[model samples]
Target chain A: MELFSIILLLVMGVATIGSAILALTTKKTDVAILAAGAISLFASIFFLVLASPDVAMTEAAIGAGLSTFLFFVILRKTEQNAEK
Target chain B: MLLSIENIALASGILLILIGLLGALTNKNIIRMIVAFSIFDTGVNILIVTFGYMPGRTAPIIDGAKVTAQNIAQVAIDPVPQALVLTAIVIGFGVTALMLVFALKMHEKRKSLDINDYTDLKW
Candidate 1:
């Protein structure tokens, strides 16, 4: 069980780090928002594997679900051509 | 086994903190930064739970069997982390909701989601 948890956590850690890097480097708002959501999901999984189910669920809901929705809503409301 | 478990827990906690800091520092998107902040919180919660674990312990809740003081102290898991995680969850919700509102307001004013475009306060 410990080994399984450790491996899951390491995988989650990599996914999170990758997503954060991608979120920063991506030029498109939609892509960045999606990356951010993905990172949140992975982080939530890490929380669960580390034995904090409550935090995992909250991160899944508020961080990944609602926040992503909010980002997309904002993205749709704003113009995408201002940066060029 | 005990030493390895402690090492794993420590590594996981450190990894979470590092990821959160990286997200906050490098990510310019407001939503991304919020997510990173939440990640950091989750890491700390995990650490709390990790401390609650013991080699041969039952759940924190008490039942009819073996409810003595020493048994309660020895066998029961710590309930503090569970409580702390609950509070963190509520706070995370409030912060996310506020961030959403701010994102909307910024959208209404600036007409763009790009952080670079919101340069009105820039000197």
Candidate 2:
């Protein structure tokens, strides 16, 4: 079990760093937003692995779910304004 | 010796903070900077939880089976950071929402997403 958890931690750490880099380097706003959301989702999983389920749930709901939705809304509004 | 999970988590959290700082500092777009800030917030939350963790422990809930009153300290992880993180998560959400609103208002006023365009107040 310890071995499995260590492997999971390594994988999550890599994914978190990779997604963060993607969020940082992406030129497109939408892609960057998606990558940021992915970072939150992975962080929530990491929280669960670290024995914090409450924090994980909050991160999943607020960070991954609501924050992404809010970003999309703003992006759409900005694009609409640009088209006008 | 191989690094423990706690050390690995701590290192990763620090790396995340650095990545977010880089993105926040370099991004030209206001919305992208906000996204980077959220990433930084997540990194802080990870660090807080990592600090609260103990090896071979369970959740901090006292269900009376796995974790009883007598063995609570021995079996359960620290609950303080989890509570603090919960508040931080909500506050982070509120702050993000406020920032997005500000971004929209700025775009409305200037018709551009570039932070460079809003240097009217600069000396």
DockQ of all candidate complexes:
0.32, 0.87
User: Which digits, one per residue and each the tens of the lDDT, describe model 1 over residues A1-84?
Assistant: 766666766666667766766765667657767886886687667556544566668778877797778767655655452432
lDDT string, candidate 2, A1-84, tens digits: 878888898999999999999988877899999998998999988998899999999999999999999999999998888887
Real A-B contacts recovered, model 2: 0.83
Report how far off residue B58 is in candidate 2 (Å): 1.2
The local distance difference test score of each candidate is 0.67, 0.92
In order, what is each prediction's RMSD in angstroms? Answer: 4.2, 1.0
Per-prediction TM-score, chain B alone = 0.79, 0.95
Where does candidate 2 chain A have its weakest 10-residue lDDT segment? A75-84
Measured by TM-score, the strongest candidate is: 2
What's the C-alpha lDDT at position A71 in model 1? Answer: 67
The candidate that wins on lDDT is: 2
